[model samples]
Target: MKNINKNRLFIASCLALITTAMTFAIRARLETVFGPEGIGLTLEQIGYAFAPAFFGFTIAMIIGGPLVDLLGIKKITWMAFLTHAVGIVLTLLADSMTSLFIATLFIGIGNGFVEAALNPMVASMYPEQKTKMLNRFHVWFPGGIVIGAILGWLIMDVLGLSWQVMVGALFIPLVIYGVLFFGQKIPVTERVQLGISNQKMFSSVLKPLFLFMVACMFLTAASELGTTQRIESLLKESVAKPLLVLAFINGIMALGRLFAGQVVHKLSPSGMLLYSAIFTFIGLWLLTVTSGGMTFVAAAVFAVGVTFFWPTMLGFVAEYLPETGALGLSIMGGAGMFSVSIVLPVMGNLMDNASAAEALRTMSILPAILIVAFFGLHMYMKKRQKTFEV
Candidate 1:
């Protein structure tokens, strides 16, 4: 390939990172507005509204992956910008659950599009450094959270600004990304650029290891994002400020992801997943039992546990299922977000009737679920590796 416009790529990546941070800032705080105390929606209802983001993300990926091949990345990136802009605007106006739901759907789709285009873009630009670069690229997920968290603290805590202002902040990055991609030429996806056929790509995605890895991705996304997004309502009784806890968890997560390559190389994905599950389980258990400052401490540990979960899932897919190309990357992201979308309501409902600790205990079932799933995944991959050698 010709020398990539490193400057343009960096600009595009920064746009993606800031936008991702913006998405989470809104998603993480959805409960603050729509929860029992805010807009007076039931926990179940809030989940229903939030479901659109994940569902829209899934829809975008399932549809956008091949479309990216057919339509090209430039069109899709612009679509993301437009949809994200509209979504944020609608959400700011929403007083009812229906409007909020639809708005979130739009934002979610936009966020998915960001993944659809940007992941492949980064991978394409840095072909030889897939895992390392991707990890560094994903630093934004946590890094953005740190930015959003600080913003949330400032807007909500310091200035007492409206949540609408927080939601509206997304537009700044949206406009910036739109402008960055305006005159630029987007290359074909990595799979296409490599001259791999669609059949080969599909076959790679269909392999047993790929499927197993996707399963792990689903659980990891659900376990990490699902649990963290619900922290506000889940720990209302234990912590004085739930948002601060959210910021703290994400702050540590940013630090961890920034340094993930060295750690992943040492521990390996499966090894990392195992330890992550253990820490998550312990952290949830601690949240259930502890109160006061210890709660924040446990939340931080939970954050550390989950730090590698999402990106590693993506990184593993890039390594093991490169054939799925951009399609696989998009699907993994969609699936992970969709899984978390499903969990949000269940968490909300548990919080509605039971105590926060009880809700946390119920959520604990997920990490336990991960332990069993990852163990099986580890063994299955081991067995599969033997066949290739034979």
Candidate 2:
């Protein structure tokens, strides 16, 4: 800890994550550009195109997880950098559904590599504060969304500038993180530090609790990202700008994540997850009923609900299932992203054939399920805590 510049590594990771996040926001914005008004792709088509971003993410994480140990985070980080560069350039050239799909696939892989390396890196860097520091590191996810959403609104919606400029905004953080990480000393994963065998690490993920969390990851991610990714389509009829609403929601998420340590102390990760599911259920329901100026109010609740979902889910595994190691974390994240790939096309079809309210109502079922799963998790953890204390 004394020799390593963990803070610099942490900052580089956050910037890397921010660069990853802006892609999400920008991709959301691009849905309109390729929709009925601009390039004339259907919502379903756009959804299919975007599907690669998640599934591609799934593939990268699944493969990159093992590679992180074999190849090292520095190599993985450069992989992310290269893919992101390619993805961005391809996005600029994208004109059809196929082009967008291929571009998004690269971007998704880039995003996956970023998480593959960074999640465990952050955990290893701050062993005592895995959950807390993870939440903090993830703050930039929404923070970058806030930055990207606002930029999209200002550049495309307000200034009437070219969308290319907005897409190019990715390069700024891209180069900065590259510079920050250059020549810095990196740490081995916690599993390596503990001398855990690769075989044991692989087997640990099969634990019932770890598998349960992976199942829950599907719903939690679908509830949060599945909705946010389609904000423009979901809220197209609203008076408020959908991207702005997206920005607002992520703004609250960033702030909440920034202060997550206190919440972690009081609620514990499982408890935090249970309450998050309950809030998400209410928030999604509110989004279905609310309209116009009231949409922001609904969004705020949704923000608070989803704020802890991603990081807390990852943190819970990293903390409780330490033996599962990077592969466990990657599987959890991969499941979440893979679920979003399934839900996106479904949600788009719903929005295409039915009303946004109907789509939202359907999406709400995910969190509703999470509420029950997380409650069981909460009680299970409480009982485990008692046993450990004894």
Candidate 3:
């Protein structure tokens, strides 16, 4: 804590995440611009273009995770700033599929670096409050989406401004975070402070439990991100304002995550995951059957289910499996994004050939799997707790 500016660093991390979330909102808006009725690209093609965003995130996290210890968090933070700057400008220039894909690649890598560096940074700064603080740090993700969604509604819907103007707005946060992080001293990760070797960290993540969580990360991420990413297409026929619905879902998520400390304390991480899975299953099923204003109600339930998912999953590894360190966190994040990358095109294909409701029904299956997996995880944790208590 000595000589470290935790507040400044945390604010910078939030800004970085805001930039990431804005991309989600802006990309959701752009789906219409590049869709079959606009530039004549198929839904599947749009999915392919967007795939780089997630896969690039996977690549950057996998690379940045181990390097966070070697190259330092500040270096990764600056890397994110530079890449986001480049990605924003590139997105503004893009009008075709190839250009959009390349732009998203930089943005995705930047997003990954943000998570890779900051997740561990938050954990290091507030070791005792890893789950609570991490949830607070991640609040910006959904919060930013809300901001971006409103901006899109005003700028494009009301003001009738060009999408390029919306893309240019990202520079505001990009500059603010860059300035905040500049010349700030970042502390070493908690793993390094505890003297955990890199090899031990790697081996810890190879354990059956860690691997099991990694697999679950795939399903959970797909259940949340894949659904949100395709919101425009999924609900276009069912709702009048899909972007508003996106904002509604993320708004609920932001509020839920802000109060995550209460939920995490009450349920514990395993219990939280179990309940999230159940609620997510119910919410997705409801979405397929509901329309109009009722869509918002269903989205609220879905948001609550996914609210604690990303942060709590990371928090669990940080608290319960601290030995796995930055690499472990990065791997979980990377696996999640990679799974979303794989599913985006599949969902897009389903949208092309089948109804959006059918696509939604298929997505519900992800949370259903999570419900079963987290149920097992919950029981296993309870048994382990009793053994420890005895």
Score each candidate by Cα lDDT.
0.79, 0.94, 0.93
Instruction: Provide TM-scores for the models.
Output: 0.93, 0.99, 0.99
Root-mean-square deviation (CA) per prediction: 2.1, 0.7, 0.7
| lDDT of residue 134 for candidate 1 | 79
Summing lDDT over every window of 10 consecutive residues in candidate 2, give the lowest-scoring window: 1-10
Model 1 weakest 10-residue run by lDDT: 1-10
> Model 1 segments beyond 4 Å from truth?
379-390
User: Cα lDDT for residue 321, model 1?
Assistant: 73
Better of 1 and 2 by TM-score: 2
lDDT of 1 by residue, 1-390 (tens): 464566776577667667866677666676877777788988889888888878898888777887787788888888888888888889888898999899989988888888888888777777776776777788787777767767777887799998878877777777777777778867788888878898887787788777777777777788778777676777778888877788788888878877887897787667777788888888888888888899888988788788888777777777767778998888888888888888888877777777778777877888888988877766766777789989
Sort every candidate by lDDT, greatest first. Answer: 2, 3, 1
Model 2 lDDT tens row, 31-132: 999998999999999999999999999999999998888888889999999999999999999999999999999999999999999999999999999999
The lDDT leader among the candidates is 2
Candidate 1 local lDDT, residue 118: 80
